[model samples]
Target chain A: MMNPKGTQPEDLVWECQACHVNLVEGPVTLMYMGNRITVDLPQCPRCGFVLVSEAVALGKMAEVEQALEDK
Target chain B: MTAFTARALSHVPHVLRGITGNTLRPGGLALTERAADWCAFQPGARVLDIGCGLGATLMYLRDIRGCRACGLAISAQMLSECRGMPVLQAAGDILPFYDKCLDGIFCECVVSLLVEPPKAFREFCRVLRPAGWLVLTDVYLRNPQSGAGDLAASATCLSGASDNTELMKHLNDCGFDVILWEDHSRYLTELAARMVWTLGSRELLMQLLFPGGCSAENKQNMQGASPGYGLWIARLKGPKR
Candidate 1:
């Protein structure tokens, strides 16, 4: 799959910040404004730590919260 | 025949295709072909195209793949254009078919517009035979917050879109096993671009439709809020106990 920016898959790199291990993309549940949203993101394989990049956090997740609040 | 054709032509302006392009759904017939190829339907497979707007996909399936394809649309006006095809005027949540009757279903960009998607999914499960395939494509929210403060957006299928996780749960809850899930957000973006070009301005169309409901700033703010589109190929599990 291409990266969020539409670049080829080879162009992107994913690594966990805390463990410094290569992170595999997987599903992670996020809580925003008391609602739960599950999205796939890079994660730490060993520690089960998921990484939410700034773009996704401020972009998609933020937008989802807004829509839910609108409802 | 002329009156029927004229009525059908009148209905065309009501469809999104009037503002965008033919085949109101994103990715158009190319995506339909891709979904059909993915389903790999066998000859004489009984397939139903839910929300089969314009009946183009149904015709393609019938003429090209030799499938026994029927269509269902909510609008009687839309059904007028589909006189040559077997079609029924009905909603997706309450299908008029017996259990385990259909071999496959093709629902494109219709689920998001459903008021009760869960009920519709259950209905899909009920109608399909064991191992029956379902080819679904629709927009999904990558970011929900982008749709806030506007009920009209839901009417446009933006607010009703589920994230991937929610979508998976819905399919699983309905006894479907997802065989493939592909992100086709690029096609949606391209369609949006085309709409922007053809309509001259999305803002102009939004204002004409929603008037005071949608504003220029709000439209800009909600731009990336629409996550993307997805294509799912799922199969109905064996009969229930």
Candidate 2:
């Protein structure tokens, strides 16, 4: 599996827990602040499962929301 | 930096400027102007701004203080937005400048986000001329353990934040003398509140921006995190050896 930018191995390992397939990095659409934004993330190539690391889920995402809302 | 985190940090200045006007940091241009005043740059003095964001403070220094200012930012998007301003794509920890060349440095709200803050401090000392002033403002953890184990909070510049003691230690260890330290946590809290009010519903806004990121429990933890913000003015020790 290719490593995503800004993600360290300890931060996240791209493998689907259910499908047991190594995740590949790609752009995936997710709902943010009621808007659909496409962001790069690790996902299972076979099962389409996106992996959200704890840092990305809480840290970056929350900051993005706050910044957008401030606008 | 991860693509998402980079995008988020790059987007913050543009978004906040739209709402809060020119100054992107917590206390606005007033605080920035005050910091510039503290730096006390002489006419034609050369200065650098670390993590310059949108170059607002650089402009202020040039136009208001008669200083020749350049900025360093990691975000290409931000540098492009600067539109001919003397901003380079660079990180604070590895400044691309000759030793003891700059007259002063102005860094706001950027320290907490640094991956290697101690290294950055050392770099700051290296770049500044002897007795050059360094003005900085950033968030710090009021209670070190308040956000322990919260990966998200760490990402938001809330985790790994040092209190006054640690900051002073870094400055002194880096061969800088503290000139001033001011608590501005109230202003930061006010800014946060203003952002929430502008969005109408904080929870709703979070849901939209980071679905599955902001749970009720996480929000509660953040509320109780006891974060604080501060501004510091220091000077590099004289006669670089």
Candidate 3:
């Protein structure tokens, strides 16, 4: 199957260590401050282990925290 | 910064209702439920929802809460979406009702958008029965001294926010005594963050939501404004004195 639009893997790919399989792009739901927001991220299809990339961690995650703090 | 066209931000609820859980404002109907619970509105109570974007609260009030709720919206486009719901097209400052007719008014996320807040307060006072409750959820200016004139021409709620002292005075002068004040700033911040994440950046979110225009500088101007959200529950004492 082809990756969905805008779900291309980042420069650094991640493999699930336990499942011994490469991560595939899929939907992930993030819960924060009693709210749930869904986004696309890399995860192991076999074991469903998600990978949080450095770019996403520092980029959108930072934005979410900045939004939550309000300070 | 590119300027927002007239009433651009005010139209946010209509454009983004799909992603915002079919409600026009932050915290959606969850905030509405909280406010109604706080007011202890009985079944069959007559309530008005000012700025009722798509009349989600109207359905909730009538079907779930068992209240005789009517909604008012300044935008005809907003009212057009309310199929088979009890709602009206009108401004908050000029409500269409006899004196002391309503049991409560849900002015959620709308007070700060009023062009003439004092006038709207008087209208809220005039339309409510004695001790009739008002539930207000709105964005507020966090830093009163800074960004004083930056949003002079913007149509967002940030343009109309005032310091707490001034806000309380407005309520008092309109014969309302506040029964509860709760800080819900997280809701506003969370919504902003979600928009930023979904749209890639705050600028992009602004551009999409307000098609007129937005620039990087407007983002800075917004940060300078330091917006916050709050919920206020008050009861009308009598006619404005």
Candidate 4:
């Protein structure tokens, strides 16, 4: 239950943006893939949307933040 | 010589998983839930729980992930214990499923019980789809020498522990790419102590259930006691086709 220190790879619980179902399981490692795009090797369990890798998810915080702000 | 069947101890996990969540004996529900939640099961994912004793973890998965879940076990008695739930009788060494059938596969404290862990890992690999996730929590070796005494010991509830290196090797050879592997030794060691002490206090009852001296004291007195166990997450490699 410890919060991640900004640069640390945070173990997060995310929902599918399209379906709103929680993506509660899988390994998401944080890596720099040039501007940080979340690479979901495994797709969403319900909708088959590619679930992003942990690294990508952590790296793409700005995009996720923007998307969240937009919503 | 005493033999233990999965059915005989089926209710143990049923009651324990409800209490502990992770099904590794008497750990608190918080640790158990944290273990289960750590798998990060995707919503509506196809998950197969091998040796889904008592269906407790499966229940957790169903409730949390809303995923389609199925189970396989060798003990009809244990399978019966899971009655009215989505479970099938099968063994870990040879799971009764087709290739790439599951997105996530989980096992709890049951791997070391397998007579052939390599075969079991192969079976796990066979059933998982490419990049499919695997979540496992079982006993491991903290100090390599601690496992030596049990190698030749007769089968008991705790008879099937594998060292950390062997476990990792089997998973890797079976085509799984390791992700997160943790040495939950302190937890297992603590459980081993508590398991012996608490179960010893209930020797008469366990004798009634097992009938042939599978009590906590008997297991504790044995030379091959393990102090460390592990939890691992790996991915099945993509299909050849």
Candidate 5:
């Protein structure tokens, strides 16, 4: 129920291009197949645009999605 | 008794205890109620719940459904939690009961985890009355060939999951007539999805299940098995004795 390692592998600070704000790791709720999970991920503080890094998009996120689908 | 569930009880029994305190296993007590309905035991009939963790289902059967229900749990911790309840500490393979003493037996998510399922079923046959019902709900394999043999006990339910054919063979060989077999696989996928979210990832779930991290072979074996949850209501075959 706690936040997992969701940021990209690199420790580089990501700045939102549109909001011109630094993305901070905050609570992000992801839903798939009628199941929801809240985890901390990088997001713009002002606009609340969540940044799901490529590593997370391909790694933990994808893995959980596959497991849910059972494919 | 070398049950995966017993081992898990030693590690993360608290988490499972949380679930069992409410509704253990897939489809929850709704499935239990369904099994009870299908079994159709008369009121005040003596019944036994095998591996009755937390004694929730045992309470339900006795209090709600009006049966004289007692339970047998393998875990000492679980048994300790049921202080005032009519529960006994015993293993499924070696139930300490007289022959033909009970009208029904209810076991959920316990048999497959056993080191020897047929042995326990044989025990069930020996103890159950000729007209007794055996209500079982557990995971089974969709792909008959896809499974881990010796290493099955390493994972959770997937470890002991054999295909429906093998299960049917076990039931038939143990002298039971299959009354019903219904697949409730969506419950498993839904629960797995919820678990994935709650634990953050499949790997975290695996880690929670297998503390200190599981081996590649164990993980691969778990992932390789195509498991499906099922409910079976069977009757011990013989004229009432």
Candidate 6:
């Protein structure tokens, strides 16, 4: 998680908003966000989730909380 | 075309010497900087540079980072030119090294042209130690729209960047953790224009260099219209064992 020499996060981080996984957990010269203000996210090391976006995480969080209450 | 490619690679050393004061092309130096800037290479780390044309990038790493480096190239003629330097003539797919022995792997503009990039990727992974860095800077397809024909037309032992997604998939499949990839389309477009202009303006010389290509003007026009280049940097994953 240390910054590689001669680089700093210019704008946003390469992090998954869902499981909070970092695709590239270190410094990068350039980061590509395919469309919109996007962040590059890695698959969850523990959960094996894919295509985890911020919107998806918010929706999932509500489902989890409601499920816990039901239990 | 194979003959042309062989001759072209032979001439690269001379051409590169002229362009760079350090006896390598600007692109080679750029790749060196890319690796050093991105990877935290410890002093005296063993480095392997796949397709180390003219050994310029390796020299840069030695000079800048004080890392012990070696180079491998396919062209014996090119390798012969690297005599007295730390380089060997070798294939990217079948590297001459033991498993998990190197601290880093540097491949600049080499993998895209391979008949089997996965093989090359696996070889790189095989040679790299745990968490070893894999830094690459090469041409890649920018427009996914340009399908097989475009790839076939441009395919060479030197370059055959079909598409970005496919390129990434191959790296991932080869067990490399993709750290960075970028489309350097604009830069390559501009570079192509420069090459075309440089060769096309000199009719006799252009013919001499590119032999069977169209007329100088036509060649220039064709090179001008192509899609651009790309770059990638990845990390070699540790072996399964």
Model 6: what TM-score? 0.63
| Model 5 spans > 4 angstroms off | A1-64, B1-8, B17-20, B149-155, B212-221, B239-241
Taking the candidates in order, what DockQ does each have?
0.02, 0.02, 0.33, 0.01, 0.26, 0.01
Model 1 misplaced stretches (Cα beyond 4 Å): A1-71, B1-15, B18-22, B145-151, B208-212, B215-221, B239-241
In the range B118-237, model 1's lDDT, one tens digit per residue, is 788899999998899998898887676665345344345564666677888899998999999988876665544434333445444454335457755656555646558899999998
* Local error of candidate 6 at residue B112 (angstroms): 2.5
Docking class of 2: incorrect
Query: How does candidate 2 score on lDDT?
Result: 0.71
lDDT of 2 by residue, B18-86 (tens): 555656667777777878777767779999988887788888888888889999888787778777778
- Classified by CAPRI criteria, candidate 1 counts as incorrect
Alpha-carbon runs more than 4 Å astray in model 6: A1-71, B1-17, B20-28, B148-159, B200-211, B214-226, B238-241
Q: For each candidate, give its TM-score against the true structure.
A: 0.68, 0.69, 0.80, 0.60, 0.74, 0.63
TM-scores for chain A over all candidates: 0.69, 0.70, 0.74, 0.36, 0.80, 0.27
Candidate 3 segments whose C-alpha is farther than 4 A from its true place: A1-7, A10-48, A62-71, B1-10, B13-15, B206-225, B238-241
Candidates 2 and 3 compared: the better one by DockQ is 3
* Top candidate, metric TM-score: 3
What does candidate 5's lDDT look like per residue over B165-214, in tens digits?
88889998999999899998767765665566445578776766565567
Error of 6 at A44 (Å): 62
lDDT of each residue in B1-241, candidate 4, tens digit only:
1232332233453323332444434243333366557666667888887877667767777876687888777767667867667887655666667888888887777776776777778878887888888877776545556334433243334456567787888888889888888765545433333332223333332343244445344444333444355778888876567
Better by TM-score, candidate 4 or 1? 1
> How do the residues A1-71 of candidate 3 rate in per-residue lDDT, one tens digit apiece?
22666664475567899998989888888877665666778899999999887667877776766655543
Best by DockQ: 3
* C-alpha RMSD over true interface residues, model 2: 11.7
Worst 10 residues of 5 chain B by lDDT: B4-13
Could you give candidate 3's per-residue lDDT for residues B121-174 as a string of tens digits? Answer: 898989899999988888887777665454544556666766666787899888
Model 3 chain B, poorest ten-residue lDDT window? B1-10
